[model samples]
Target: MRDRFTPLLAAWLRLLEPACVRCRLPADSGLCPACVDALRAFPLPAAAADDPAPVRAGLCWSPACAPLLRRYKFHGDLAAGAALARLVLPELRQAARPELLIPVPLHPARLRRRGHDQALELARLWGRELGLPVAAEALRRVFDSRPQTRLSAAQRRRNLQGAFVARAGLPSSIALVDDVLSTGSTVRAAAAALRTAGVDGIQVWVLARAPGRPTARLGSGHEQVLHEHATEQSGTHRLIGFEGTKAVGGMA
Candidate 1:
């Protein structure tokens, strides 16, 4: 197989070479040097909510991190997922050898339409790189709801209510993987489901947070919007998904 495919793979690489895997900015060997530092610099634990459960991330949801995730999630860019996974592996390690690395599951309809699960792709790459077991099926999405992107904060919470279920519970410590966390309602809902299944320690791992949205330092204009919406709510956990059962509303 290697002999037969090597030439074709070589041709593809030669044809597609030198595009920065993240921003496609003249690849300086996979990721540019600036992206290298961006990927590795800063302490992720410091940025998370000061809960006992340690949560870590790769980059703040800034302009630097958006392009890559958009490319991978919306444009079907699988390589970007692997590249981003390499960026987040260090933080994943901080969670300490979790019994299972689970990617947030998508509904079957969306998964089929998208032709991929971006989080699952990242989790698989992460598990491979770190030699940890990736449980793509550990948690199942019971609700086939609308995309959280379009819903308001309240609707997001209600939409996701009882949306997840765990088939086989694992250790107290479990790492959940997602591409981006805007309001964190999704992760918290998923975590709540996991908690119901008996897992105690849950840490979320994401590629980016809403820039300057309290949880992370991404430099998007949305930060002001997030801050404004956040003031209305009171709690350590910020609402990433829309609140209220109403279909349309404001976001944080």
Candidate 2:
């Protein structure tokens, strides 16, 4: 049976190649202890303080989180995706008892290029672990939008508008899963689409969030700085301190 073969294959893979799933560092834990700790170190905060949604995130987005996600998404590293999702599961467990799990949908073009949807994979794995139902068809991306990484929060919001729509007959309560949350634009847009379809309650789940990351600016000289922050390409925009604890008055 395929199920029986899975364990045997896993054992063979382990015997033949024993290394951390992401970086390939020597380890039995799938990821090195140091990398595991580093990935797990980021705090998971409520979406908001007083009116927080029934949501939970595993870690904060940083250089480490980005690289792992990029490797899995761009490099076809299924092992790393599973390992990262495993790390994300503990916090996700706190969102217990959802009626269904909906991974954020990707546009057909991106999905075709990547050959897999990382969020859906994570959601399916998480659902299996929690004895919950995974509904990949409940939501769909109706429109393709620009990448959010380069846009400001406002621009990101604009880009994501009308990007998602929930299919008919989805349960009223459910959890939306994704790999990361930058400015919350995509999630919010997806949530809005779900609400429009009569979904009563929605919870957004992401593996990592960029805490206190500034929102998109309207225009003027400030726009350039905002773009730079959002871009924050390698060798730039390192996290110097906690939100509001350092420069930019907590605007990330």
Candidate 3:
């Protein structure tokens, strides 16, 4: 019977799998302990005291974490995506639960080129772990928009104004999943469309959050900085000191 041979099949497959892509270690998990530990060292703050956006991330985006996501996103690497999903599972367990999972939809053109939607891939992984439904086709991108990475927050908002359209009725609450949050324009637009269709509560869940909000103008305030510290310097942005001490004044 297939059940009788399941364990044997698993063992045989493990033997043929490649080493951890990041460390070249013999790991069937797609990542070794060392790389995972390095990622944990930079997990995002559990919760920002004054942040109102219901966004949550496992790690802050960094040069080290970039390759893992880029490989999964651009190079069509499934192993990298699963490893990153495993890293995010713990944080999702610690957060408030949601009724359903919805991935930010991709334009059909982009979807054809990539061959898969990265957000949908991540949503499926998390949904399996949490016993939630993944509504991959519940919302659709109505039109293609410019890449958001280079745009200011305001510009991003404008670009996505009508990018997403709901394909069906939404539930009262759902978690919107994505691989990363930069200016957050895409998620915001998706949420707005969902809300207009009667979904009242929305939670934005992502694997990572890129550092800084869309940059502000010259001589402007340091709103882009996630951390605020009052140190012995005039124009430097430092994270809150260890244990969140090194007291700084004013709000971020």
Candidate 4:
């Protein structure tokens, strides 16, 4: 009799659990197992051949992930952000270890509006998990330029000109952390600022890489390896079935 009632008790408990934020299904954790696997299977971005600083991203940006990221970035959903940070840990561990982690700073005005710094939060989460130090104030966004999401590639580069300034006393090697990578403008600008301050060996780590048009110029032979890997995994997005769901509202 006890064994027969165990199944019923488990079903009742599941009904009482909170729903998954991504799929709205019964899940005690913010994300269900299926959603987690789907996100893990997302493709990695093709390495940018032009950028000198090597880039490593946990997953490629797509419609399935846009809502989840928007919720964390725009709506102050710390839970969602924590989930993303957890997902990116494996990629971070496999990359070249850095002495410190520096989060791309937001302009003061933008920080005031958003109420929290998503990049900083992610850096903190990773630092605790990886036992690495984070220098949140090493880099500052001096210029409050327009958002890059709406700008053309050229405009994005122009907007970030002199946008970042790094202070002295930084470590020789560090990884710059951010939520997403689009045209690579933001990290490029940030890396330039770090280089100017005499810091050497910079790497970029982001949660997702937004799909962009192919570039004409290419880097070394390593670019071909990354491109081929990305191409093979390009179809992985089809495994995620969240495309038809209602959009989660947030700024890109």
Candidate 5:
């Protein structure tokens, strides 16, 4: 009798659910199956040949996925955050696994405003899925820097400098987990801190890689800009271009 009503219960739940965030179609989940397929089908850009840190990402950042991240990161949508983790899991499973997962820490002030740390949330979700332990306290943000979204690459670097400090007794090899990778300033600084704490290996993982362009001259021997080039195809912009990176990686 219970099994007989299971389908009906599921159907009723679907009716009461909200529409898919991306397509505005009725969906039990915030994201529909079709949108998930589209996200999986998006072509990933080639890794930067000169990138020092091994990086893995689930999707390329675009207008299509930006709102999902914004909702999760800024608006405190745990469901949206779970959707993103599901999307990124496959890519992370393919990469080199670390002894532990460490999220880029949030300053106390920002944590108060946000109510939850996005990176910590991602790390916990991933830790449970991947069967790894999360060292949430391994790293701490010593400074409460301004937001990095509107800042240039140089400014981003300056803003995040000395922002992270790692605690002792961290694993020799651990992956730094975050929501997105853009200019990479944040992760580079974080990785540097871990190095200072005597960690030997670091892997960077993120849900998406945002498009960026090198503002500094390529001839200056500075970090080259990695950006996604948009090509209009079939009424949608195809995200194709260089994988964005700096000296390392971070979410902007």
Candidate 6:
């Protein structure tokens, strides 16, 4: 072996423990202040829903803010998750203000594959920050469905129909937590299940909200595979490969 690459290898090893998640700057936390500021500016306009409860999201999904979610969602990056929570919690604390936080449930299979429910993690983080209680078992994903990418709003709704079931002991008023609110189908289905279970008044508190509709309606069969790949590198997932992200129906 030669010494030609020693300096580069040393520099990479030194940079392994970066100070900032996005900018690679010197900082005490996962994200530096500059990156945080940039992220703050990506909040989308609040959207209205026709469910039993209203839905609110903290940030708009953009290149700057969207990719950060993959780190928290699939790579087991709790610090990244915390940074994302810091962004969404303030909005929910001020807006939804529900005393109970209900993380959207994952299907048992998906839960096993992903190793964690991103929504549950977010709910716990928000609960701690807002001094609220998190009821992660309030709802359940009764069945699994196809990956949500490339589906239309109608198809998304159809895919999740009868998929979620809310349990008893859920509070009368609470907010449902999810990582990304895409088309809103998942939350709607979750909310409907809760309502059917006699729980009243639901709100959606999600971290990122995709800004507009997908460019095309072409159905791609790579949704689940892409998710697995995203988890492998933490930076490879793009607009179509959101892991904890939801789909094409009306979002909360």
Candidate 1 local lDDT, 67-180, one digit each (tens)? 666656654556555567666667667766777788999887666655567788777777777787888888999878665554566787888889999875477778898887
Q: Lowest-scoring 10 consecutive residues by lDDT in candidate 5? A: 239-248
Model 5 lDDT at residue 249 = 19
Q: lDDT per residue, candidate 3, 70-92, as tens digits?
A: 65665455566767887788888
| Top-lDDT candidate index | 4
TM-score of each: 0.72, 0.74, 0.74, 0.76, 0.75, 0.76
Q: Total clashes, candidate 2?
A: 2
The global C-alpha lDDT for each of the candidates, from Candidate 1 onward, is 0.65, 0.66, 0.68, 0.73, 0.71, 0.68
Model 4 per-residue lDDT tens digits across residues 1-252: 999999999887666566676887866556789988888675676787876488888877755566677666665666677767777788889999999999999888777666678799888888888889999999999978775544568997998999999998788999999988777888899999999998999999888886564222223332332243223221111112121232332211
The lDDT ranking, best first, is 4, 5, 3, 6, 2, 1
Better of 1 and 5 by TM-score: 5
Shift in Å, residue 151, candidate 6: 0.9
Expressed as tens digits, the lDDT of each residue in 1-252 for candidate 2 is 999899999876655555765465567655788898877676654465422245567876654566666655554555666667777777777775789999988887666655567688778878887788999988899876755656666787788778888888888889988876666777788888888888877887776765666343223332342343233233212211111111121111
Candidate 1 residue 153 C-alpha distance from true site, Å? 2.6
lDDT of 1: 0.65
Global lDDT of model 2: 0.66
Between candidates 1 and 2, the TM-score winner? 2
Candidate 5 local lDDT, 127-156, one digit each (tens): 998999999999999988876645787897
Every candidate's CA RMSD:
11.7, 12.4, 14.5, 10.2, 11.4, 8.0
Weakest 10 consecutive residues, lDDT, candidate 3? 223-232
Query: Model 6, residue 69: what's the lDDT?
Result: 75
Instruction: Tell me the deviation in Å of residue 142 in model 6.
Output: 0.9
